[model samples]
Target chain A: MLTYPKTELNKVKRGTKRAVYDVEQINHILDAGFIGFIGCNYNGKTITLPMAYGRIDNKVYLHGSLKNRMLLALIAAKEASMTVMHLDGLVLARSGLHHSVNYRSATLFASVRKVEDPEEKKTALKCVVDHMIPDRWETLRPMNTKELNATLVLEMEIQSASAKIRDEGVVDEKSDLELPIWAGIVPLKQVAKLPVRDALLPKQLKTPKHVVTYYKKNKT
Target chain B: MLTYPKTELNKVKRGTKRAVYDVEQINHILDAGFIGFIGCNYNGKTITLPMAYGRIDNKVYLHGSLKNRMLLALIAAKEASMTVMHLDGLVLARSGLHHSVNYRSATLFASVRKVEDPEEKKTALKCVVDHMIPDRWETLRPMNTKELNATLVLEMEIQSASAKIRDEGVVDEKSDLELPIWAGIVPLKQVAKLPVRDALLPKQLKTPKHVVTYYKKNKT
Candidate 1:
């Protein structure tokens, strides 16, 4: 299996046992979520913001307004990093220290570049919209030239990445196992509720196949 | 209502209409979730990592192994920032540019200081635990001296903060109202499934009240 080469940058030092560098595993974690926390240095202070992203191969795409500060900082720095995480469950343990959360998280270190070509930018935009809802982009009104010019599309070529997954039940001290405290897992998930049709939508316009399919697959 | 004083560092530049500075609202956003994406400068590169946090009054607490790189970096810098976001839904619109996510997100910039007082550290730790599941810490086995010594707790005093909330339905263009496209919102939420007792637990031991309560309140 192909794996990202570990460097001092991407190494998971504290939890060595939970760290994973396999490219496929990392990609799996990335594909499971569309929102990522992107870190950038603003005036030498590190700040993070959540943004929707799309991944194709090793490239992750992010788009924002032309004056978006975080994206502008990334462009100025010529590098970026983003982290995506899915909270799976809560691990309740007999001991306070052992109480943890079950989660799958991945971090990518990448070089950032603007997608200036019109065709590539269009593809990236489609990738982002479709990433949130599969096959929905084609149904939307295409971007006009003014809208295209106002958006800034960035492509991040991942260099090294790491993922850490903790999917097990609680690990309390052996001595504390017999304690009367209750310990277990509470599985967590993001589920969809009933869809709300827009007020402006025509009464005759039924929800499309893609919308119905997404809801059916995601609803609890 | 008291509100956080916004500085250039914590200003919401792009989505001015959605910006919120009220302390109560920002705390509500923070209290809705325990996990936060903390940003820190590592070797001159910015990286974000997910960490469980606790808040009390105006201070936020984070604890990790003494060797955690991100925590250590925050200590060395003596300042930190973290972002917490709760995704609410997918806003499907008739145009690609209008596609967005309904979310409540907050960002905090703070000065970081290590909690050295044993009593304060214990309180902070309890706050962190109880934040995950209300009233959970009192039932767990208390931390031993060794465990306390091995953990590093950092207290972040909030300096400036801002929140952005988008809880509305789709806002499509007036011209696209007659289009055949389907536009609406697929509401999303994080929910809990049934609790699974630890395999090691005695068969006679029942799930505790706190766990049951949390599940009942969060489950779909």
Candidate 2:
């Protein structure tokens, strides 16, 4: 069911091979992340560019200036690939040699197309804004024609996607078991520190109820 | 300059044209990452793969198992393209519309070649391990011939590269500065927690100084 070369990947590169993949994991990582690394060949040159993104209905939407050339390379090509990853936690094994990461990430494979119509541009913008903050688009003022004209959009239908992960505790080689060292997962996580408010606002400024709501989410 | 079209990436897209790249940032990002992602079209089919790697003086050394078709594909063709990235921080905007990231990442352009001799393999391993843990090679046991036979090491010298960054704090976007909402960076970080001990017989295990040392190193 997995297309990645498991045996070849595992047998040769022991460090990267330890990563695991499953569909449920793919959704969770994407849902939680706001950035993706977009890679494409530009004018016969290769590039991996970082960008903020949103996913819906099995497709991903990305935007930039209309003048950007990578869009042309992608629009004219048969395929392009993008990846997003989160460094979950550091794996601290009994032996320092065996230490690894507990990471969550996804790669997307797709055929690309450009979105030229202004109506679609507006929709795409709202999709992204809403993805970052639920119900945000509904409250904000809509974009003007000038604002819409300045943006560029590309659609990548996720043709095939997969997630690679290492969330379990550390695995020790048989020879290292008796060594008197610590071993296991020392869970690493991205935590929201106490909110720092913009200084210009009065002391009464507060976090939105919805925004403050994430406190109960997995602190890990 | 920036290669990607501006309209495609959604809410998490750049807040300004500044987030796009010129040629220099692309090369820097490629030069800095610890590893990268590789995907290929195989006889009308495609595969996405991830591997641990190290960059030395602009040359990328990719080590894995001899069984990997990726290594075979690259070495036979004498060229390949891969994407590498390093995530810095997450941007949490006040209006969700303006939220972004503070990131420093790179992806390199390179070609693959086999590292055939024992000495060369040892040198490449040194770079890989040291890339993750500086001053680490001197502390460990060097690989034996049996271990070398079980591994595959491919070298890919970089040809070109690029970088893009999102480093600004929450952009109040002028017009929204008056909104009475908390706005600031949550400061995302990847940290190593305290290590957990092995399940077996050690009654008095303690973490080496590096356990706390490494965690202190991640200032992110």
Candidate 3:
């Protein structure tokens, strides 16, 4: 069982009991979501924005316009952290203080670099697209040189990471447990609805296999 | 409509066309989700974590244990930024460069302060719990003085904010429209499933009205 090195910077302090450093567990959390909150410092203020990302082994791929501010700031800092979370359920506890949401979250601290090599950049773009919907990139039009030049691709090598997950029923104090109060979990999920084909698409062109497969896999 | 005063801190740099500063729009985005990505600096490294929050007017409420690292850091800095995003769909385009997601995201810059007043602290905690599910606070067991004292609550007065929303369909190159490729949206939504009662719950106790209402409102 591989694990991320425990360091001062990446340690989870508040919920030590729920914190996990196992590499496989952290990767599972990352693979569950495509959008990640990337932390960046701008003019001495820390801000986080959700960005589309794809993870491969110890590397995470991100792409944006050449002038994207967050990407540029990360590139300048040479270090970054990304967090992904999936909300599983609402823990309705007997007491207000114990109310919490069941969730799986992972935070990765990494060394960042720009993917400037053409072949590597292309592969990274493909990874980003495929991360969103499996096998959809193969159906898309190939990228041209101009589009490639206009885009900026970044690769971050994971150095240390930690994941925290809470998936259980409500926990209430023994005294309060006997009280006449409702306590349970309300499960939540992100689902995909029916796909809407582009209006400009040819009437005869049915939805592709990859899109249908994605919908089937994601729909409840 | 009221708007947040735009400055370098809250300005949306990329995709400026989608930037929204209207206060109502930003609040609408915030109210749609309870979990927000809060960015904090620790030892010169910026890290983001997902935290449950409650919003009232220009103020956001968050509560955690006293030793929580992120909350403590935000208090030390006396300022913080939180971002909330709702992913609407995947915008699959014909070209790789045009791939995007339909989402509504808002970032808020705020001044942080501890809610030391006992009354205010109680309200903040109630707000945080009820924000997860409406009318939920009344159903929970009341908190004791000791419980109240153990919790740390922070009130962030929103100073500036901005939102970016992309709700439209795929935008592909004019030349690529003729290509025999699939381009469309797979609408995504976070929805609630039926409530799961705790195993310890008495069989005679039926699900509460508030819980049923929440499920009815959120279930697809």
> Given candidate 1, what's the lDDT at residue A50?
99
Q: How do the residues B19-123 of candidate 1 rate in per-residue lDDT, one tens digit apiece?
A: 999999999999999999999888888989999999999999999998888888898899999999999999999999999999999999999999998889999
CAPRI quality of model 1: high
Model 2, span A105-171: residue lDDT tens: 7777777778888888778877776665455565454566776777788888876665666777777
* Two-way DockQ contest, 2 vs 3, winner: 3
- Give the lDDT of residue A219 in candidate 1: 89
For residues A164-209, could you state the per-residue lDDT of candidate 1 as single tens digits? 9999988888999888889999999999998999987779899999
Chain A vs. true chain A, TM-score per model, equals: 0.98, 0.80, 0.98
Candidate 2 regions off by >4 Å?
Answer: A1-23, A43-46, A91-99, A116-120, A133-141, A179-183, A199-204, A214-220, B1-33, B38-49, B77-84, B89-99, B135-141, B170-183
Which of the numbered candidates is closest to the native, going by highest DockQ? 3
lDDT for residue A56 in candidate 3, whole number 0-100: 94
**Higher-lDDT candidate among 1 and 2?**
1
Q: What are the per-residue Cα lDDT tens digits for candidate 3 across A1-220?
A: 9988888987888878999999999999988889999999988999999999998999999999999999999999998999999999999999998899999999999999999999899999999999999998888888989989999999999999998999889988999878888899999999999999999999989899999999999998
**How does residue A36 of candidate 1 score in lDDT?**
99
- All DockQ scores: 0.90, 0.30, 0.91
